[model samples]
Target: MFILADDMGFGDFGVFNGGQSSTPQLDDLSGISRLYSQHTSASPVCAPARAALLTGRYPQRTGVIDTLEARGTDRLALDEFTIADAFSRAGAVTGLVGKWHCGAIGEPYHPLKRGFDEFIGFRGGWQDYWDWTLERNRTPVQADGRYLTDVLGDEAVGFIRRHKHERFFLHVSFNAPHFPYQAPEELIGQHRRTGRTERVAVIYAMIAVMDRAIGRIRQAISDAGLDDDTLIVVTSDNGPELGGDGEESADRWNVGLRGAKQHVFEGGIRLPLVLSQPGVVAAGEDDTFIHLTDWYPSLLTHAGVTPVGSKVLDGRDISGSFTGGTVDDVPRCWQWSRYHPMPTSNAAIRDGRWKLVHPAAAGTLGLTDRDEWIDHDIKRHPENYAQPIDEESPGWPAVGTEPMLFDLAADPEEAHDLAAVHPDVRARLATALHAWYEDVELDRARLVST
Candidate 1:
């Protein structure tokens, strides 16, 4: 069972740093599950991150670098091999019970056609919690006045109940705490009692409700007697969406990390991960760098199935790393250039403790100026929600022309830049990052041509 939270930050959980609201269920889960302290989402945005999570490859390679449009022709290519397909081929029941933002316009890119036997969720990037359209295996269904998060949890629990006797790969994705900040008034009042602002209180309330829903799902797994057989992994698609007015509260939830979502900073891409499988994997904390893309191969390996496709995977199986083992400390590159074929903005590469960041202006870098690609919530509530921009934000600095280098080991907040101090490390990492960009662009070009 894989549980994914939408737009949840590292510090949102008590296991990470204890935000204004308590997450007792997740805290207890961390006590029994392996806490990955150095895990990162594959992308800074939604659709791309999800694409990488499902395919075990970079979103750029899968042609899902941007969020899909409702009327546009952009979609995840049908040729990409998915983890659900791998498990289903291995004779296991597969289902996805949450946000399926990978693709939605056509049947070819639908979740049902992408290897999932069951899919019950919304297809767009954001949906209303109180009222929204839902589809069950590509068919529209009534929501029945239930909260979206709870609906997903109920569906996941039902799937587990029905398939408890067989091997199942259930992806219980919760599109919670993302936008509109809607939750029960009781939950909202609970956070408000903590002396938090209205915006922060609403966000925390949503998170708290989501945590409880996850706890219910966990209990369902335990009750089904499939805890030992299920390799459960919980993580988020991206970091938290910090509003413009709540910097202090953001620090409380983000643990003083620099930058927020939509940037390549640690706070944007870094995530909190918990992996548990009872007797198979031990419970402990690991700082090994794990990407969302790695879940594909890791889950397949844990399911005792060999990958049957000839797709070139950018992710490595890190199942051993959960059991007091180590993985290769190689350079990992992350890029974010929406609506552009070439990656030229907010690109970064991490090699050991040194990280090189290439930040560019909004209009420069040959990237498309997607000024209208604002979040729905932000558009509805501009004062309450804000994009992670440096001009309006205090801690977030403007991206300079010169690439910056930071020793994450010493400066996790990215307060200091060592680009000039350590030229050798900067040159090596920059060269590698540029080379990686070249490779990604070349691969994309070849795929486009063929």
Candidate 2:
């Protein structure tokens, strides 16, 4: 059962219904995609998403609900077990081949310390595709400086060749179509000839380059006859860059999704999760609701391994949902954290058509509140993290404000707020959101109780 997820924007592929470019590989794979609706990343941002995706626990419980905005002593706790640890315990080889921004420099939270048998690519999120200044397992790899995308693909293929005989998991994280967005000359030339002033061509070129490199990896797997045994899951860390106008042209980036990356809007949290497992998942789409945390259980189940213990997992194992099982009605939730307090309570609860967003009040920073704090702290207090520190509370302070509600099943764009009209739904979802969060706190206490 191999899943290949791409951080495909809302319109990156043609099969997206409102898709713009032609993503033959993804569109074809979607034949059995299971249309998992309401799937979301843990944080609206990247660092927190990876922290949650790797630990199978909500970022809030793991002290990483926000980005890795540490000065020194504020590092990711070393006691946590990541997905790689689970795979290792289950008797499988685990490796990471991309971005790992979960800790500060030289911290124990490095990928090698996080249970990966092998590590390649940068420890941070973005790196120059042309010049490889990124670190691999905390060592300088001396990037070719010609093009970055090609090198990342090459590394994955090489890793596959070396570990083909083992039941190994390869996490190929690509820093493509990401910032410092630089593609090759041939690709750039091809797009430039397209005659569109809208940098859509450049963005498309970036995706194209990534797709081609990915095809190489896919070919390597097939060549080694590992397609049947390998489970390839490829996806992005978050939504697209929404600034494709005069500023940079990605603002129109998500094609038409409601929000862009960075904030808790749909565009930022809603990413493409493409799973292509031969013989296991029938080629088609399923409209089930799931999220990043769910992948830990779903993949482990498919691999026929039991977890360390029931422990406390925020994600669910819906193996049946992937194997053509019908989906039951369940709601999804989101928490947005950055620097300052999230405008309003800084949470969202989605149940059926009703979706609630705890809006940042008129006087509050709103979307920028939390992010502002982190940014300011990093800038002003960079030296404040020079010494050892005491343990702190587990989660962000709960925001006490009215939530802005919308009917996603009714208004996916979130153009209208129904909070004033549907007080009952708002209250119900609000209660559920808070209770769920409290449960996360309780789990942390039990698992790491002193």
Clashes of each: 0, 39
Q: How much is the lDDT of residue 161 in candidate 1?
A: 90
Worst 10 residues of 2 by lDDT: 386-395
Candidate 1 C-alpha error for residue 230, in Å: 1.2
RMSD of each: 5.8, 4.6
* Residue 359, candidate 2: alpha-carbon lDDT: 54
lDDT of 2 by residue, 1-450 (tens): 233233456567667644555455666656644455556776677666777787677766666644444522223456677777778887778777766667644457678888888888665445666655756776777766657777777888898888888888778777667766667666666655333444666666777777777778888899989876666665666777665556256544354567766656677777776666677665555566777777777777778866654447777887786668875646666675443324245567677767787753344323244444544454333345443233342344454567778877767778888888989888888888877767665654553464
Q: How well does model 2 score by local distance difference test?
A: 0.65
The candidate that achieves the highest lDDT relative to the unseen native structure: 1
Off by over 4 Å in 2: 1-7, 17-24, 31-35, 68-75, 192-199, 244-247, 253-255, 340-345, 360-401, 438-450
Cand. 2 TM to true fold: 0.84
Off by over 4 Å in 1: 71-74, 193-195, 246-252, 363-400
